[model samples]
Target chain A: MNYCSDCGATVSLKIPENDERMRFVCDTCGMIHYQNPKIVAGVLSVRGEQVLLCRRAIAPRYGLWTLPAGFMENGETTDQAAAREAHEEANATLRDLRLYTVISVPHVSHVHVIYRCELVSDDFAPGVESLETRLFHEHEIPWDELAFHTVRKTLECFFHDRKQGVFPVHNLAFTIALPT
Target chain B: MNYCSDCGATVSLKIPENDERMRFVCDTCGMIHYQNPKIVAGVLSVRGEQVLLCRRAIAPRYGLWTLPAGFMENGETTDQAAAREAHEEANATLRDLRLYTVISVPHVSHVHVIYRCELVSDDFAPGVESLETRLFHEHEIPWDELAFHTVRKTLECFFHDRKQGVFPVHNLAFTIALPT
Candidate 1:
């Protein structure tokens, strides 16, 4: 944001005469640059009685377990992104994926969309970003070793919904505590 | 991302010859840098027959209409983000914001999580990031003036679901054409 896209001039943060907050405005083109948060989408692929999980091959929370998920790419739909992530992380194809949960982590400026996907086939293995991939029954979930809070929340909601058989049509909320 | 967070030294993305993408050795702190896509959450506030829409005060699409939404902050859940956005943009409190749509726009690297929020109060004015705010009935919606593809799709889904009196429980695929 140091340089202006409209003109090759340096930009400055200023409060507009009509506005109270300061915005980065280009003196040359009078353009105001506003940056918004990004969205992350993934799938919770499930076999009859088991859920698919991936072991991370990269850092941040490497060696930890997680569902197949990734950032949404341009021009692709959410379902498409979910399917793509499933293919990339586990080489799994999904049939019906229901909107499971939407988790927001404002501190990191991201929104996570998790889908409950029915596994179309048993064909799966670790992909580029995954070290290992496996299926875990409800009782066998690696709860303590799960990589992110959103993943944990999604699983919790899924199990709760499965039990209630009511499968709430409404969205739920939870908080994630980051390690200080 | 190949750098030491502690000592500011360069790191490598390569895994040791024998390691199966499991171990990432940092040249400095020897710490692995793990990366993951973030989550974003927002609300689709509906007031009776009309839905709340905001004109973005910032770019990528400045002055374009959109739902009140933003990225999820750390420690906050998706539902929290949705409520927060609704308050922030429309100054409206929501009750029973059912999960409406989860759109993954891959090309832009974002997963849009939209909730169908019930407007609790009519006390709303334009927020800081909004050029202007207004409510539009289904037929009066400025579809062509929407800021993002995901927003458009979510609204369309809302109407479709409203017609059937059946809110979608699953994620659906949609393609958004780039503006000509």
Candidate 2:
């Protein structure tokens, strides 16, 4: 941040008193601007034996297939955010929601929490942010065209667990490899 | 926030085009400043049949007892944040961390995530943020003296789960009553 949002004064990065990390401290207000990771809430909405996927119409992996998800908003639970994303991105309603995968992507400062839920009905359409929304069987999933690693990982876990007729919450951390 | 952190411009809250929520928009730079809920990571450190608690040396609940927790910092996983908080507040190291209670406190826009872990050693002391650190047996826990709702809920879930010998991850949301 170039300026303090509180005082409109220039800010400098420094370690505050009794703190070990460097933070943006305002010159005038002395306010510390702290930034934390964000939660991306989404859902793996299931029909009989298929899962819903939305083709993004927005930038940053545009046209790629992904589970309906987005940055969680304030004043909402993670599950609420996940359900809302399903409605907003794919015009889909979900039921029987259960916490599935919680993956920490520290390199991008994002915690992706995906819920495994049953689609309310087969009456979903593409929402504004999606070019198309469709249900795909496990063998038909666009694995190579998936938008993100978190989505891919969640699906991998879901299908593997489905065979055993048991689903367990998965907690994971992912790191992107730096260029050699 | 009164000013844009990006350009030092005055800001006004409004719903941007194609958006449902009101966000601070910079008058000069037109930067949208969106705010979201933060994650508070903590731990329930166990030794034998006791769990650790820290007395706060900080504001909001000075001297009140709680599980060691703090606002999660950037570039860290939730489990890492929980471990760091235990070390920072109680001078405690933990092992065998398992995801436990995840509670969303929407009134304050915070998600409190606590991990159940084993205390590494009995050599522990209060850290800078704690006035005292102590281990309490289930019967000796100061239920009414707990600092936060999330902590209480976590402990309640833990003890109840311990009896069944099955500790399933609990996902919950808490709401505080507004003064009548």
Candidate No. with top DockQ: 2
Error of 2 at A65 (Å): 0.8
Instruction: Score chain B of candidate 2 by TM-score.
Output: 0.97
Per-residue alpha-carbon lDDT of candidate 2 for residues A22-98, written as tens digits (9 for 90 to 100)? 99999988999999999999999999999999999998999999999999899888899999999999999889999
| Top lDDT prediction, candidate number | 2
Mind giving the per-residue lDDT tens digits that candidate 1 earns over B1-180?
Answer: 333433445656776663334443468567654433334568788778988898998777998899998865544656776788777777777898667776555444555667787887678888777878788899999989998777888887888888999877546544456678
DockQ for all candidate structures vs. native: 0.23, 0.88
The regions of model 1 sitting more than 4 angstroms off are A1-33, A166-170, A173-180, B1-96, B103-114, B120-166, B169-180
The C-alpha lDDT values of all candidates are 0.74, 0.93
DockQ of 1: 0.23
**Candidate 1 lDDT tens digits, A1-180:** 454544545568898676545777777778775545455779988899889999999887999999999876555666676788889888998997776766656666666667787998788999988999999999999999999988888888888878887555435444446679
TM-score of each candidate's B chain against the true B chain: 0.84, 0.97
TM-score of 2: 0.98
